[model samples]
Target: MKIPNNLRLIVNMRFYLTLCSALFLVNCSSKTDHIEMVYGQTGTSLFQLKNKQLAYTVKKEGQMVLDTSLLGVTIDGKNLGSNSKISFLNQDKVTLKYALNGIKKMADYKGNIHSYEITEADGFKWKLEFQLSNDGVAYRYKVPGSGSRTVLGEATTFKLPESTRVWYFERDSDWKLKSHAGEWLSADISEMPTVSKMGPVQGLTLTCELPMGGYALLAEAALYNYSGMRLKAIGNNSFKANFTEGDQGFVVDGTITTPWRCILLADDLNALANNTMVASLNPAPNSELFADTSWIKPGKSVWHWWSGKYVDFREEQDMVDDALALDFEYNMVDDGWEAWEDKWKKIAELCSYAQDKGVGIFVWKHSKEINFPENDYTIMGHFLDSVKQAGAVGVKVDFMNGQDKYIIDFDEALLRKAAERKLMVNFHGCQQSSGEYRTYPNEVTREGIRGLEVNHMQEGPLTASHNAALPFTRYVTGHGDYTPLGFTEPGETSWAHQLGTLIAFYSPFNCIAENTQFLLNNEAIAPALNFIKSVPTVWDETYVLPQSKIGELAAIARKKDDDWYLGILSSGSSKEMTIDLNFLKDGEYSAEILADDIEAQPINLEGLNKEANLRQWNTAIPFKKLTEMVSVEGKVTIQLAANGGAAIRFIRSKVEVK
Candidate 1:
């Protein structure tokens, strides 16, 4: 092969050219194969998926119901979906099987995950992930990038079928300070009514009953370092993305994966209550950070704020002693805890006192104290460290008052920083939970509901109707700091109704809004108090009984370890119902029940009128009895008075009673 040098060079060049041509052809073929392949999943073809230019179409019942809803992101002035060429990169389908921890501990989350990876012409990559469960479907977009990226807006749309009836709350500009107020209304999507311009804009979650059998819920999940999402009506049964804007809009560093824009489909209301997709869509806890979550306990805490008293050391110790006697985990020193001279020192002393009694202390601070200018990163970090050094277990940051991108970022920053210092957080006067606790388990609870504290200022009292609706609506999103188990007299609902809230409404850092004197001195509900003390805030499993109605009644059963707790709430009028205990293992069990005393003076019928003075409504009553029964057949019946409720604790019997 030792030919002339020129001839040999020419031969080598030709050989290289031929190899390059073959490699190019193979690459072209690979790209062509990826583009041509139809990536999708089918559950009996009732749900069909297809994508082009990031525009996805979902076919339901053989009809293209959700048509050409484009999913994209806007950065600066450039739109990714509009300006770039899109190509399919890959597709995969798998079953996601996992267990929950924290608020929903011991719950099983199983679903089928379908992931579609695509690339844009400008080199931006996106992974559109969809989870198809028996209950509904949810999808989120993930993008991997470097450096800081300015996110102008998100382009996620939902085009519903015409003639759908929707239920939703209007958003509040002052979302941080007040509970999400206003009533839930049923309206046709095509002719949606306008919300009050003085208050914040529309809320995030929207429920629409499709003309076709099932119902659909539009909500978001895993909101972190991004603006909370709200849907704006774009006419023609179409809604577009309306993000909560921050000071500099929404920006992300390194990577920006938007929260899951979820559409929960349900055949019945009960299915909506049972769906855990919101929590499942979020990433699990960092086991490395919370390896031994034993210290992360969820139980009742005595909050001094509801009493409207500036808690001095003496009052603080009384509450701490009360929590200790009640076997409660924490005693919260709210608002005025820092007003005392040498406040930090006094707090440390109280912490020591409480710690010895096996009770933890939660200190309170304004949200402004942890945000920029007022308290920068260095100051916030030092403050948390100081609190941790003081032996306080958690911090109740309150009065956030906004749902803009800035406030969202601030809320997330507080969680992350508190976690770094090994402290728990309970956000008051803040937006609803977007499954942020799944990422940072240190977030104990958040107050975004119209709770017991509102009794002081609300024109009309919070009703059982509102309470009944919460379990399916607000509570479905995440933990509601409703501040349940109040023993104050002249309460809005019957004593039994308040007791049931301990189980119906979930909050890890559950706050008992009444003073210690009420629980100890009230001879009428002492047995009921004992039941409240024994109830666990976090549950392993939850079941919504078939009798649940959005604005009328809510009956729920939650399990922790071997015991089951049941809570039933009724509105408008007295009622009777039976609960099936079949969810329990096949074994005899002892049930301790506390129900309304029907013999007590009936709630003033005139006061029940919405126009009557709220003070006239009777909220306190004597309990009928603390009855115990052996249940082997797995069924029990109880009666509830008007605006009343019941709570029961079921424990497996050690001896099988014949």
Candidate 2:
């Protein structure tokens, strides 16, 4: 039941707590100054708001996980939750359809919801809504009043047990407002305040191990029109929400609704890897805007930029021809294409040529050229129109580096513009994901994780441990365009290991960055070509093996239709891992494996970047092959070299004839 604004506050607090807890079926909480708010059940989890205080506490399974922390937002230099009155508004159920353009077995979102009202001292009002589910708790602030408001910042904070361990990324020096495209780091929650000794510890997407029973992945969701939020260490085991522009702040016009502050609670790492809480907070696509999803079928692509970024009209046609041979859906023309003498005319000719062979062209556009606000959006509109007119299926928007409210707004506007032109989107040089894809189906993939392209170009080699950490850390938020499989450079891992990345990382518009001529004709890769050719870019289901650990090893199985694809990545040292086929159907099935050859000496290929040498290559580290018939109770075992990986495929067999 909702408390009316005119309802008088009870003069006696002790009596009010008792009345609300014992006699009334109210949305209010349990006895005395300590009020239990989130879904008032006896056990499990509860978000408590202490009476006579504006702070909040969190408990799980009757164990304290978080101590009292501040709860309020500072708007125009006014503290909204201070000297204010709060009343429980109402309770309802959270229900959402399982709709997505592509990704794992589409997850469902259902929970119990409760609302509270916070009326400031001057009578200004806003709403706080919390949704509690078995997966976790998500809450957000919604201001009912309209008009432009400069948000100073939020007072929300998280105080955890000192013993909690955290896995996160330090903020990149260039991008102070965001925490993405950086090396992964770890520290105890207690050590966070002093982490400047290690590096900056401000902008973080943290996955923390609670001292009690479960894990909490602290992140934000539905980041459409607000300054992006990151956590700043505040001494001890506490963190305060830091806005994108720091003190200067950003303006939110019209209705002010912030993204959901989420804690994805899970019992094990597997559940954590598969958490859908981020997507749960965002609304589904507008039915009228996205009535036809037939244009959204996802598939693999052949990319020219990932291979090197040097593009010309003639070279692009070769990419399209290679895509046709591989039966791929799209051919990406990355940066440097615009430098062509007649870029548009050539792009149109290439798109026309690829269209006849069942291939679509995805052109690249720099955000600096079209995404700014001065030109009245005409530049962006014209670019989208030109691509659609050229028969291109998608646009890759690059160099969107900030997360302040203005940049966030521009990102959404670009998606809307591309959607109207029926063009898919791949956001590169962008901020980390907050499950915005649930609302924008045209967004096929995005770059938030430090992916393969960076690794190939950087001075150092990509460590397998970083690759191993992705499944649990980065991928949990949403799809990562990790443009996997860069074969030209090799400093770590065997050739087969690079092939395995094609299955490990989750990117709907999967782009292969290897030398195309080498990938097609290298006799050494012939045995594994079939598996690579048919790998599923979008999955029906995913299972993280129980043996998996962050930054050490990642063994996962994904299902598409009747076949199962397994990707295993191991780091630090050569080790043996096992796969139990317990999830397979009852009948026998055929399995084909492409794995690291532990004993073979890797062949030296210093000239892989040279076209003359690439075509002449016929030898490399042997990809150990295995074929067997297995059942639900059977197991398949493989050994991995240091920084090694493998890809396996399984197909169920038919019943035998009598």
TM-scores, each model vs. reference: 0.84, 0.91
| Tens digit per residue, CA lDDT, model 2, 1-658 | 8765545455466678777664433333332434455543212222335442356666665666667676778777887775556666787988765855444767876688877776666778788777777667777888765688888998888888878988776443664344277656667888888765434345546888776756778889999889888888887688889876878888888777899887777777778877888887888888877777677658888887655537878889999999988878989898878888877888999999999999989999888899766665888998888889878999998887878887788899898888777789999888778988888878889987777765455333556778888887778888888887766664465676777777778888887777777788878777877777888788887888888777888887888888888888887788787889987768878999889887887766666665222323333455688899998899998888878888888888877699
Model 2 C-alpha lDDT versus the unseen true structure: 0.76
Please give the lDDT score at residue 272 for candidate 1.
73
Q: Which ten residues in a row have the lowest lDDT in candidate 1?
A: 39-48
lDDT of each candidate versus the true structure: 0.70, 0.76
lDDT of 1 by residue, 1-658 (tens): 6799999999999999878654542332221222212223213111112323345555444444465566677766556554333433434454445545433455455566655555555666666566666656677767777887888876777888887877764333444224455444456777653534533235656767777756677788888767777677777677777766733567678777888888776666667766677777777777777676666677889877666546888899989888987778899988887888998888999999999999999999998877773444667788899899999999999888767667887887787788777889999887677777777778888987777665555444576777887787777767878888654533557878888888888888899887666676656657776786788888888888877777688888888888888888888777788787776776777788888888876433332223223466544654565556556466788888888898888887675579
Which candidate has the top score in lDDT? 2
Once all C-alphas are superposed, what RMSD does model 1 give against the true structure? 8.9
lDDT of 1: 0.70
